[model samples]
Target: MSPSQEIELTLTPAQAATGVVIPVTLPSGPQRLRIPPARNGDLVRARVGDTEVLLRIHVSGPPAPAPAGKSGALGCLVALAVAAVVVGLVIANSDDDSTPTASSSPTAASTYTPYTPPTYSPPTYTPPTYDPAPAPPPTTEAAPSPFDTGTCLNGQLPDSTTAQTVRGVKEVSCSADDAHYRVIQRFPGTHDMSRCDANPRTEYGFSYQYTLNGSVINEYVYCLVGIGSYSRA
Candidate 1:
């Protein structure tokens, strides 16, 4: 094969039933391709362009065993030599006078001290005495109104078209079952109902005007939306 020509080599194992492909390119002169060791029945395939060649692997069996008679005689001679050495050692040890002997006198009993645990005393914990804080003086000022902007109320409007002075409207939680209206926007220092017209969602308008000696002091316009029963008229 030419050096430029490429050969596709495939190896398939008999036990695995799988094929592996390896590319091989031959040199201009003699070249050697090392093939991997395989089982006895494995197959090797080589392809050059369109032509393909398949080869089967053949592995030789193991060598025959040695004769058993010679091995048995050799083992017997080794055992006899070992036995002779053991007998010589036993005779030599029997004549020795330096071996130690056990004493015939009675031994003293070993004394043991009993274990004692250390004494542990629990610490006494004394509760701290604290003087109660004096109760705040009873507040004489009037309670502030709970109704404000963003606060919800559960009440019907006395008049929807004309702005009415808001009073006796206790604020309720927005999630409460009795909540009927929610204050969307509040205009401080002004009681004009037209200010609430900018918000399309405003269904009701209420004003809070406080006067001191015939002069307006504190005023607020609350733009409200009805929850369920009341809607924009």
Candidate 2:
């Protein structure tokens, strides 16, 4: 029996009438109790906590009839023998009623691992670098002049004797009514009037000068002729 287990012993009405005397309850732990002599066929009920068991009493020898005159001594011997038998039977039955405790095996302890959040690294911020578009490569091409050789003019030339610079010249188609002069040739980088003498159709020459801060920086010349019914040759 386990150390903490308890038991209860009881007898039926029939067994009690036969004069059985046994402990009604057994508390936890080791204890001792007495069993009164009982008949061979008496039944005792044992309760171990919630379970119940029935135990049968057995005597080794049959009862002898008591002598008619001297019953006390013979009865005493029989009672002693019966008591021993009852005690033995009670012990045997009690042993059968005991429950064997099963040993508990040790269990493996579980290991707990805490969750760790992943390290967060914000993305590095790099501002965009912008360089002003490289200045357009310095233009090597020169600006185009308003008048080109072979073009017709609509206005008269300025009086070369008094004019220092020519202006107000309007180019037109030779077929128009207001067409006045046609340029036969032109000279760049020089304003010499003699350059027009090489062309037979040249009747007038004009010098154009570009000045900055009252000093001539560059010049051009145009050789022209009155467009009197002139047709392209």
Candidate No. with top lDDT: 2
Please, what are the lDDT tens digits per residue for candidate 2 over residues 80-174? 66443322222222323232221121111111123476999999999999988887665454544647877888766654545355566677887
Q: For candidate 1, write residues 118-182 as lDDT tens digits.
A: 99999999999999999877545443443567899876677547545456666889899888889
Q: Which one is best on TM-score?
A: 1
What's the TM-score of every candidate structure? 0.34, 0.32
